[model samples]
Target: MTTKKYSRLKNSFICFIATTLLILNGCKTNPPNAPDDTTDLGKVFISANVLGAVIWLNGNDTGKITPDTIEAKTGMHEISLTKDLYYKSTENVEIIKDTTIDLHVTMEEILDIGKVYVTSNISGATIFLDDEDTGKLTPDTIATNSGVHQIRLQRPFYQDLSKEVTIIRDSLITLNFDLVEESLQTTVLLEDFANVSCNPCVASNQIIESLTKYTYGPEKLVAIKYPTNFPSPNDPFYLANSEDCDARMLYYNISFAPTTIVDGILYPISTDSVSVKSAIDQRLQKNPQFRIHVSDNIIGSTYFTTVTIKVENGSGINFSDLVLHTVLTETDIEFATPPGSNGETKFFDVMRVMMPSNAGESLDGISQIEEEVFNRQTEISTSWVTNKLHTIAFIQNVVTSEIYQAGSTIE
Candidate 1:
């Protein structure tokens, strides 16, 4: 070959080799990359509680809306979502190669809570708002939603009072309840003497129960039924404690199956509602010369009570032989079968025990304005329901057998 032609051919051969090397280099899997290589991408699905929210990634606009999926490099990424009038949501996400991630966000609504105060004539009245029990009593302050609601105050003796209230945001609403007492008079005591075996006692018991159901209260009229042996020899109540029954029987000189005594005066043998109510009305008309207050603390089957008797507006009648009688009574007593021939299945306000003795404690005479206090501690028997027990304390004129004042406590 000629020298010039050989040189050209050699150059062409070099060019061909260079072009082949370039092609091989371009097809290589492992190539030189920048410092922040974002080629390895992952996917993400995002959703939020609010609509029309803008999404941002790594402080830069992703140009994507919520409930949409996006593609990004595999690494830790900062995501933020924002909407008008709602809290902004921020999250940190880690993306993995060939893996998809899901994100959900929720925004909170701003609300202003209000305050409500409920009060009544007596304390411990349960408060209810919009028929929902607040688990609060009278003279209490409660945090409630800001709106109009119905309010109800309920207690044992006092009539339930209801009212409508409107509460504004960040405002206070006060509700006052002048609850009316059920009985129109002060405290009164009713002593009932009966024999459980006597069928007539059932009618008398029904009459007394009817009166007590509407007017019964710790502060109003209270009753105690004595089960005598004549009615039934197997009387459960009489057998439970016979000493108290015998003592009360001797005091009242009771000989009948059903006899009701109001204060100190005995009513006619008729258990008619008119006759019973008449006797009660006469006693209620008279203003009691003294006031009694009873309080108790119960721990398990043991109960401790404190009673105070304060004489007020005494008409200068110096009482002789004033006795403070503390009696324990049980209500809502039930029996699987009738314990006597009376066929009564339920008994209420049955005398259980007398503190000290049925003879009672002697008290000093109150001339005008004086007071007497008594403290008693008693351990209840397991045969009786502790929750159904109560305490009754009264001052009586031993000579007249008249109950001047009385106080009772169920708790």
Candidate 2:
């Protein structure tokens, strides 16, 4: 019986060892849950503005050229950029697990509306902003809200003009006009570039007055009479200012007497309406960066002058170099002419003299004034006035003598 019992125990122990081995083999055959293949993070693409420029990721300079791709972690990443004439910009981005990311940037500069031009047959015509007068119908570079605006035109003895204008993505807009004349406020500078014995000066004055009356009423046009070549004993209103006479011969390099300069340019009797309109209209298309608000104050002896300039900021252009000048005008002075100008008299809004010629400020520039936040200011003063004086101030190029803006005290 003892022998049988020992044999049974040994068999049982063997069975237990066999079962343990089987379980261990089964565990080795099937493993726990885990990923099968290796995963990868995404790449990042960096691109600066349209201008070809360098880009940096974090602090390291990626050898990759612009529009380059760099290795990145699958989560969040920070970026830095550097370029010429531009400020550094930083941005945070999230890179996807398998997809690449693209980024862009923006920049700033000086000068808003580089230039504005307006042209019409009636450039000398009055212009209105909203309901206020904006000097003559010249191409203006005015900085205004990016929206719709009302514009009106008017001239002496002619029909008035009114319209709506839009300022869009571009800073420049050319406003052209086609107009008809009803009345004329024509000023005939009847220059007799002839000898004292010349008799045609008489006929020229008559024609000039007729044109003035046809364009504008009598209150508008002025007739300045002068003799040229040989001095006439009857000379009254003649000054060397006229190119027709000996005094202005060297000044204007002209040797003719029956010549006239309309507005600020030389205009002969032969100029047709189309040519006239074309010439005047061309000036109206130019955009000016600065505007003028002339204020004349009576503070003691000196006339305090304030010229407020409103400049618009945008785009990539900047307008610099500012200079201010003022002119005085007096009209309705009667002068003896060859019969035709009798009682017709003469008038002049003469630019007598410039006030404190050094009022200079950069009208349209990339940066603001040193207070370092916004715009800047400039002004000058003069006490000398003859009561008939009206002031016009403008921003001009000191070397080129080209006026960018014109403002009248009356405006």
Candidate 3:
């Protein structure tokens, strides 16, 4: 072969190999209509109320969290925002090519707002919030908002209570209340031992008449006068019911005339107002252990009396051999003239009859709260005036000789 022919052939083969290498490299670099990034594709901008929320696009991970923009195709895509302590919010969004679509998501917390626990010492009390009935009783739970609120507790026969409390977020607020009991009225009894013939009885009687009309009226004091057979052989008032008069005189151990007893305690039988007022005041200061209520019905000569005794809060009290006495008495007994030599024309609060033979009913000592009711019907004698009659009930401690409480029918 010639030298010129060899050189030319070698150069041509080398040039062809170079051209093939250039074309292969160009094909591997990029294809036609292919882009370096998604510059022309649609974008999805996601914003959420909660931070650090994971974002998903078209059931695929976008590798981007919330408050970010994701490049997507021009079509409908499911966009989701999720977090550990928040509810997942999802929506389908349509993307427009070369444009951004904003997605605003509102996520809800996973926990409740607040809770409240209401309780009271006494069960079955109604609960109220902000003056609105909650329809919930005591020892119950309620779901409410987090803030300041007013709570009220109410029950029958107990004082109502209201209070203000603050509720914390994602926490429980407990409210406990102790109720108070209602107040009850107190009553007292006055026992006067006198004979119409006794002259000193006139002044003593006058003093008692004024006391019965005190500020408290009929509820303040109750008087029962028993006529005695002292200082006169045949006292008309005493002879009217000698059995009861003598029984009372012997029971009180009265050895003189015009003796006055206030709740089984002896008081001076004189016109001195200070001594009488002091004795009555001392009895009124004592707290009564029992409450007495009496009612009566009269039908011709038949008298019906009902006595109710309630042992209220006997927690620290002890009773031994207690007796209940129901006595029928007449008030303002007009004699037109002096019934006896006492010169008193009117006899007030005179003992007419004793129920249950005067021995009284055996009241069992109660160590707790309790009530006892007694009823008696007796035929009234024609000698006693029925229109002015009243029933008096009392509870007495036999061992201590102290009268605990007394009540009566004023009318």
Candidate 4:
């Protein structure tokens, strides 16, 4: 019985050992369709001619410098290497799974590179370097190749500031600009109210033309003539722009033709050369309180005018009820036949149209040392000559009817 029991125990021990060995073998071997335990990735060994170049993989910064190894998923990739003061180097690389590729870049160093810090009295002025826009404003620094460069600053209502700067290699320089404000030129306005049908207007026009065109020229005086309805309502200039013509005539209470108004002062029925010259001379002696600039351009059938007014000195001047009047005049208009009873065919400074309206443009918030720009455009009339068109701008007080300053785009 004892021998049989021992043999049974030995058999049981053998069975247990066989089962344990089978379980151990199942854990050691992998299933047929199981996935891999390790990832399939590639590495890149990157280096540059110059050390310390930043590395970029597929346009993303890898936060790694030169002479480093970077691991990436197996695919195509764009590699970029960049360093300060050196031209960037780029290369396309194909990454194979479980493989490392060596990449060496020959970087070109920029020669004689320098830095410039630019500033202006007034900030935010546009900066131009070597006549090309740098797309940068003032109070900023710029990096460029060392050489001679032209720098300019442009701002509204201020004169452009320019300078030639020499940039030295490996050095920094600062440029400071003390910009000047643009001042207005002193000018006198001659407002003439006359009729083509009035006989005396011929002499008045001749005398005024002599004084304005020859004696003073446009440098000091600008003249504009308003045709009137009196003496004859058939006046072509009057009939063409009657609203403005009559409004100006009534503004000065003009009752007759051949009347001249200088600097908003009426001279009724006086075409005297000596008196008119004296009025213009006296007005010219006054200092310019405001600056007026007038520019005109014609595109197709459109007449455009830009009037820029700057307050040079607002002291002791009435800012309230300030009006800026822009008028388009035909400098010289000749008719084959007399358009009125006066038998006159030639006219100078004849009013064609008032910009915006006959009432003129009212200005607000006019203060000392400030500038305002007004743009007015009108359709050119087919009957009016294009080449003879002129723009005249003036600043006046609506209450006192005193013209402060005047300018024109004659020249």
What TM-score against the true fold does each predicted structure earn?
0.55, 0.32, 0.54, 0.58
Model 3, span 114-172: residue lDDT tens: 77899999987788877745668999986666678898987644668998988777888
Per candidate, the number of residue pairs that clash is: 1, 38, 0, 0
lDDT tens digits by residue: candidate 4, 94-194? 98898888999999988989989999998877788776455589988877778898899976557888999988889999999988876555688888878
Model 2 per-residue lDDT tens digits across residues 81-193: 64533445677888898887788765442222222355677556556655545444554544443456676776533566767787554477777766675421111122223
Evaluated with lDDT, which candidate comes out highest? 4
RMSD of each: 38.6, 43.3, 48.8, 37.7
How does residue 406 of candidate 2 score in lDDT? 57
How big is the positional error of residue 107 in model 3, measured in Å on the Cα after superposition? 81
What tens-digit string does per-residue lDDT give for candidate 1 at 107-147? 65436567888888788888987774565888998766577
TM-score leader: 4
Q: How accurate is candidate 2 locally (lDDT)?
A: 0.43
Error of 2 at 249 (Å): 10
lDDT of each: 0.70, 0.43, 0.71, 0.77
Error of 1 at 134 (Å): 21
- What's the CA error at residue 298 for candidate 3, in Å? 1.4
Task: Write down the RMSD of candidate 4 (Cα, Å).
Answer: 37.7
Query: Which 10 residues in a row give candidate 2 its minimum summed lDDT?
Result: 27-36
The best-first sequence of candidates by lDDT reads 4, 3, 1, 2
